[model samples]
Target: MAEIKKIGVFTSGGDAPGMNACIRAVVRTAIYMGKEVVGIQQGYQGMIDKKFVPMDARSVRNIIQMGGTVLKTARCMDFRTPEGRAFAYKNLKEEGIDALVPIGGDGTFTGAEFLSREFDIPVVCVPGTIDNDLYGSDYTLGYDTATNTVIDAIDKIRDTAASHDRLFFVEVMGRDSGCIALHAGIAGGAEAILLPEKETAIDELIEKLEQSAEKKTSSIVIIAEGDKNGGAYNVAKRVKEKFNFYDIKVTILGHLQRGGSPSSFDRVLGGRLGYAAVKSLLAGENRKMVGLRNNKVELTDLHEAIHNHTFKLEEDLLEMANILSI
Candidate 1:
């Protein structure tokens, strides 16, 4: 085990609400442990560009409550190439950083894995995506906040939906995963939810809406962006063609779900995951991810964390959503 004297931390992929909180945790934890911390700006691109900033407890002060990463984030096509990774590693060596704590989703972890294996660097990761689709962690950092944001929007939309007796198609994020759509749909009391995980036929959806129309003055159907019949716009178009009796409205939540003061749950979760990530690296752990599983912090092999696809939506929750809609 190499003695890790300095650690580098960065946030990548889509910016999540509690990422700043996680950044605060990483910086403070590393400082307290008598090690130096460097903030890598714009993620892997920062390494290739040599964008490094010295960080201390003061540098991360007053940022725990902030949304988005203070370190910033960007998608780096350059990081995917071997020559790009070599340049990144060279920059890391020049900066005296021997270990890393990266906070992001699978794409971020994949890059970290490549860099670590190629350069023999030590790494520990914190799951920090709003998608919450990562396998090892039960809940990713900003997922709670993102869902809360969706619910809040749903509540407001319901008001207008009821006022005009309209059928609304509200679309939320989740291209490959439906975690946000499933969770927020249930909490917001939508009439039906279309998920990427489940192929919801248009006829079946209309059947439910017809059932809803008989008893309710207003209806809200939550749709994941990756739903098989296409996004909210196409689904609404098809539904409007046949079910034209009710006035319809389509709302794409877009990136709105990605920004917010993280919920209380997320703030604490970020802190815990960040603290755990640094501790794991200090304890000579390498190429592992720190995650919260079943309310306990646990470590999973980074390869498993990146490649495994076992995360599933709760069956009971799915049933409950269906039953409660009526």
Candidate 2:
């Protein structure tokens, strides 16, 4: 194994809760190993453009409970290009960086894998997206926190819905996958959940609402943002037309789910994943991602994780939703 000296860490893709905790853990762990840590700003772009800052224990202090990333994050479209990758290599060589630890989603890991192969430097990926769509991992770092946030919002919205006897269409964030929507919908006690994994027919949803209206005064339908059939607003319009229900409201939980104090689950998960990432680097494992499987932290090849498709909503839960709502 190469003598551990200075290591670089960066957060990429969308910022989420527990990111600061991950950054803190990596910096503290590396320092305890008698190594200096470099904070790369704006993810891969920072490396390619030579933007970096030194990190210390004090830099991460008081940030453990904070949401969002202290190191900041960005998406660099150019990093996939040969010239950009070459620039990253040259910059790493100039800075004498021994290894890199990237905390992000699949796209970020893909870039990390490319940089590792091109530069011959070890890169460790820590799954840190709220999406929970990364392969080989039961849960991503920020997923629990995001789920709790969505549940909280739903709870508050439920109170208003009941008071006004209104039907609310709550939209949660989840682009290509429905992990967040499914988990949050179940946990939040939503009446109906529309996920990307299944096609939600507007006619069926309206029929359910019309039937439920006879027994229940209010309703809440959680819809994923990536719902191809329609969004909450469009669904609300169709529901009003089909059922003549004019009290429908749409609330898009946009970035609110991404911001909040890191829950205990997320803080602990982030700490463990961060430590595992450093351990992987120390163990001479390169271009791999740290994930939890069988209740234990494990490593997987980043390339496989990036190329594999491992996302699907639980069928039993979907069936249960259909049974209870209809």
Highest-TM-score candidate: 1
The TM-score between candidate 1 and the true structure equals: 0.99
Model 1, runs deviating above 4 Å: none
Model 2 vs. true fold: TM:
0.96
**Weakest ten-residue segment in model 1 by summed lDDT:** 240-249
Give the C-alpha miss distance for residue 210 in model 2, angstroms.
2.0
Clashing pairs in 1: none
TM-score of each: 0.99, 0.96
In order, the Cα lDDT scores of the candidates are 0.94, 0.87
**Candidate 1 on 1-326: residue-level lDDT in tens?**
77999999999999998999999999999999999999999999999999999999999998988898999999999999999999999999999999999999999999999999998999999999899999888999999999999999999999999999999999999998999999999999999999999899999999999998999999999999999989999999999988986899999999999997988899999999999999999988999999998999999999999999888889999999999999
List model 2 lDDT by residue over 70-161, tens digit each: 88888888898988888888898789888999999988998888888876889999998999888878889889999999999999999999
Residue 277, model 1, lDDT:
95
